[model samples]
Target: MRALALASLLFFSAPPPAAAVAPPRDAYPDVARAYWVELDGKPLWAGQPDKRLPMASLAKLMTALLIAENADLAAKVTISRGAQQETGSRLGLRSGDTARAGDLLTATLVRSANDACRALADWRGGDQPRFVAMMNARAAKLGLRNTHFADACGHDAPTQYSSVRDLALLARAAMKQRAIVDAARLPSFRFRSGAGREYRMNNTNALIGRYEGARGLKTGYTPGAGRCLIALADREGHEVLAVLLHAPERWWDSIGLLELAFDEAKRRSRR
Candidate 1:
C-alpha cells in the first residue's frame, strides 16, 4: 500500500505532455475563396472547392471546348451586331466581320475576348440563350452539379456560377482538345477579320512564357468574380492542374500552390 501511494504521487507530479505544435498555418492560407489542386490525376489539396461562385471569363473555356468539339475550325463565323457590342476584353470585331472558327476560339481562350466568345456562341447556337442552354447541358453531362451558366462570356449574373471543383473538371475536359491546348499555351494570338482588320492580343494568363513548364489553361476577372484561374503545368511527365476562384492575388497564389503541390508529390514519391 505504501509503494502504491508513492507511485501515485510520482504520477501526479510528472510533467504534463507538451501541447501539440500546430503547423505555422494551413497547407494553404487565404489562397482563394475556392481552390483545388491536383497532381497526376490525384487530389493534393482543396479549400471550399464545391462552393459555387462567379467564374468571370473562365466561362470561355466551355465555349472554346464546345467549339473545338462541334465546329469545323476552317468554317467562317460572321460577327453579329450583338457580338460587336460585347463589353470587356474584346478583340475589336465589328458587325459584318468574319473570322475562322478556330481563330475565334483562340482569341476567346487566350485573350478572354468577350466579343470573340459571343461570336463563337452565336455561330454555334444561333443565339446566346441557346448557347447557354448547351453549356448547362454540357455541365449536366459532366456531372458538375454545382455549375450553371447564364452568359457565354461570363458577365456577372445572379444565375451564372461555378465551383472550383467544377472548373477543374471543365478545364480538364477543355484541355483534351488539341486546339484548346494549343491556343491556351500561346503567349499571343493574331487573326484577321473579314473587314481587312487585324487583331493581335496577348494571352490573359500571365504564367505563359513566364512560369517554366506552364502550359495551356485560362484566366478571368470581373467586378464580382474578382480573379480566377485554371493553371496547368507539366514537368518530367507529371501534370499539375490548379483552379482558383475569387483570389485577390491569383498569380502569386497559383505559383505558390503549384510549387507546394509539386513538392508534396515529390515527398509522397519518396515515401
Candidate 2:
C-alpha cells in the first residue's frame, strides 16, 4: 500500500507528462509576407510586425494626414513646377494650375496622385524637405518608431521606409478624417486642370468595392516595395484593420488577411 501511494504521488507530480501547447496560428500566408493585428481595443495577433520596408505610395497616407491637419481644406494652392512635374501617377496639374487643398487631398487619397501629394506637401511645409520633417515629427508623436519619410508621394527614395505596423497606425489616423475616408472609398473621380482639361482618377485599392464593410484605404507599389495595401473593414459590428507589405499580389493578400481578421473577430465576439 505504501509503495502504491508513492507511485501515484510521483505520477501526479511529474507534470502529467507535459501536455503539449498548440502552436500559434499563422495569421498570414508565407507568400504574402504580412503582419496582422486584430484588436477589440486590444492586440490579439501579431507576426513579423517590426519588419520595415518601403511603403511605396502608401507613404501618401501620411502626406494626406499632415495636409489635412495643417492646411485649410478650402484654401487654394498654386502648383509649383516641382509639384506639377512629379512623375508616377499624376493628376496632370500644370505648374500654374490652381486648386483647393481639399480637392488635392481627394486626388491624393483616392488616386494616390504623386503630383497632388507634391502640391499638398509644398503648400503645407513650403517645400518637400520641410514637409518630410513635419511627417517624421508627426510619426514620432504617433509613436511610429520604425517609420521614416523621404518624400510625400513615396517615390523611390533610398531613405524612405516603414513597417506594416506603422502603416496601420497611419491608416487608423487617416480614417479619422472624414474627407480622407470618403476619398479612399471613392470608385472614381474627375479633376480639371487649370487649362480646363479634365483628368479622371480611380481608386487604386481594389478591396474597397469588393469586400463587405470595406472602406477607404491605400495601395502602394515600387520595385523595392513590391505591392502593399492598408485595408479597413467592419463586419458584424466589429471593425478590423489589416496591413500587408511586400506582397506579390496585394489585393488577394488583403482579402485573405481581412477574412482571417473577421473570422477571429467573430469568434472573439461570440466568446
Candidate 3:
C-alpha cells in the first residue's frame, strides 16, 4: 500500500506538458507565413509570431502614429518633388500641391497612399531617412525587438522586417490615437487639397464593409511580402485583433481567425 501511494505521488508531481502557443501546423496550413491573434488584449493564438518577415505597407502604422504625435493636423504641407516621385500606390500628388497634414494622414491610413505618407514623413522628419530613424527608435521604445523600418512608406527592402507579434503591439499603439482609429475605420474618405483638387479614396481594407463587426485597420502587398493585413473587430464589447503576414487569401483567413478569436474569448468567459 505504501509503494502504491508513492507511485501516485510521483505521477501527480510531474509537470504537465507545455501549453501550445498555437494549434498544430496542419490546423492552419498555408494560412500565412506568420500570424497572431489577440482578444481584448490577451493572446489568443499565434503561429511563428516572432519570425522576421516583410511587413509591406503595414509599416505606415508607425508613420501615422508619429504624425499624430508630433505634427499639427491643421498645418498645411506642401507636396515636395520627392514625395510626388514616390512609386507604388499614390494619390497623384504633384509638386507644389498642398494639403493639410491631417488629410494626408487619412489618405495614408485609409488608402495606403505612398505619396501622402511620404509627404507627411517629409513634413515631420525633414526627410524620409530621418523619419525612418524615428520609426526604429520608437520601435525600440515600444519593446518591439523584432521590428525594423527602412522606409517611411513600408517599401520592400532587404533590411525592413517585422513580426506579427510586434505589429499587434504597434496596432495597439496606433489605435490609441483617436484620429488614427477614426481614419482606419472609414469605408471611404473625401478631402480637397489646398490647390482645390478634390479627391476620393476608398478604404483598401475590404473587411470594413463586408465582415461583421469588422473595423478599419490596414492591408498590404508586394511581390516579396505577398499579402499582409492587420484586422480589428468589435462585437458586443469584445474586440479582436489579428495580424497576418504573407497570406495569399488574407481576407478569408482574417475573417476566420477573427471568428476564432471571438469564439475563444467566449469560451474563456464561460470558464
Per-residue lDDT of 181 in model 3: 93
Maximum-lDDT candidate: 3
TM agreement with the true structure for every prediction: 0.89, 0.86, 0.90
Prediction 1 global C-alpha lDDT? 0.85
For 37-95, candidate 3 gives per-residue lDDT tens digits of: 77788776678988999999999999999999888999999998879999999999988
Error of 3 at 192 (Å): 0.7
lDDT of 2 by residue, 116-206 (tens): 8899898888898999999999999999989999988998777899887777788878888888888888888886655676878778888
**lDDT tens per residue, model 1, 183-235:** 99999989887777999999889999999899969999999999999999987
Query: What is the C-alpha local distance difference test score of each model?
Result: 0.85, 0.76, 0.86
Number of the candidate with higher lDDT, 1 or 2: 1
* Order of models, best lDDT first: 3, 1, 2
Q: lDDT (0-100) at residue 58 of candidate 1?
A: 89
For model 2, the local distance difference test gives 0.76
